[model samples]
Target: MSTPAEFPVTWAPRRTRAVLLPVCALLVVMFAVIAVALPANWQFNDRVLMVLSGVLFAAAGLMLARPRISADAEGVTVVNFVRSRRLAWAEIVGVNFRQGDPWASLDLADGTSLAVVGIQSGVGKAQAIADARALRDLVHRHGH
Candidate 1:
């Protein structure tokens, strides 16, 4: 059994953030250094382009850490790479994080399931399972 999570709690992929953010920072720095070290024949525009490319790469890396789940008294908000959805407690019917699954998912009242990427098993298995259980408890306590 998982311990109950407090209200207004937020869960994000800790390992993902820990790993990606630093790697992204390193890549960005490398890009900048490469831009500065480019041959003199390279135009200023070309160097700028390299720096811009690095920024874009960092942005993409940042997206990998974007998935998050925030729960409060009113409802739960799920944020994925490019989409964010808010669901009331009643809308969340169940939480599932079976073995081999990449992440947890929510069974919605609308007869559809929503992937909860914030609780990814591949990155941190134990934490993800605990979170899934906590979310299940929340659904049971608040979902009708």
Candidate 2:
């Protein structure tokens, strides 16, 4: 028979589009409108500035599509927007979720905490809290 600790555990926040691609698209549209609405006498530099601002918004939106946390027998992997870190269970000491924190994070044995962007407070308090507890449990059951 398989033991409880032997089972793999994967938990992530409930995905919401409240601030994802839809918002990104809206931001781009707004920028586009601004670009077109600018004075006809404006120099080429003004239009370039608007396009660059739109590009930044679109890039931010694309990054939001890739946050998650996954863990199994060996370790855990935290995939934030632009950075990803993989740590063995032995390297993690605990999980933390504090008020005002944007997301859940793991307390590493090395004294540094690794943020798990997959579970974010932006998703809502209840959901973020629940995921934090679940992640903490996984650490408790599997890690130190």
Candidate 3:
């Protein structure tokens, strides 16, 4: 016979990119337009290349738009650009969101640190602080 299982998520922060990407896109567009229009003389290829490069750069930044962190009974899952990390509650030794840090970082028992990009400071200081507090509470309640 198989046993039914239930795992409740303790906490999950709103992704910072939800607030950042739109603002970043607006700024990128404004700057791109300025760059294109400010020049008195420009070749068609150079203008095309300039605009293409600007768009590509913005795309690279948007790659970070999918960062997220989720914690359930089993563990925490952190999804940041290009990588994902899953850690057990006991593996987390500490959680720190310091004064100048971009996002929260988890200190593990193995002496390594992992970044949780779902919560970031730049979007809004108050929101970031609240998210960090919530994360710490989750670690305290679910972790050792």
Best by TM-score: 1
Expressed as tens digits, the lDDT of each residue in 1-144 for candidate 1 is 674546798888978899999988988999999999999999999999999999899999999979999999988999998899999999999999999999999999999999999989877788889899988888888987
- The residue-level lDDT of candidate 1 at 16 comes to 85
lDDT of 3 by residue, 1-144 (tens): 111123444223445455657866875786578667967787767777777777776777676676777777777888887788889998988889999998888999999999887777867777777767776777776787
Candidate with better TM-score, 1 vs 3: 1
Ranking by TM-score: 1, 2, 3
What tens digits encode model 2's per-residue C-alpha lDDT throughout 41-67?
Answer: 987789778977997978888787678
Give the higher-lDDT candidate: 2 or 3.
2
Error of 3 at 36 (Å): 18
RMSD list, candidates in order: 1.3, 4.1, 6.4
On lDDT, the leading prediction is 1
Ranking by lDDT: 1, 2, 3
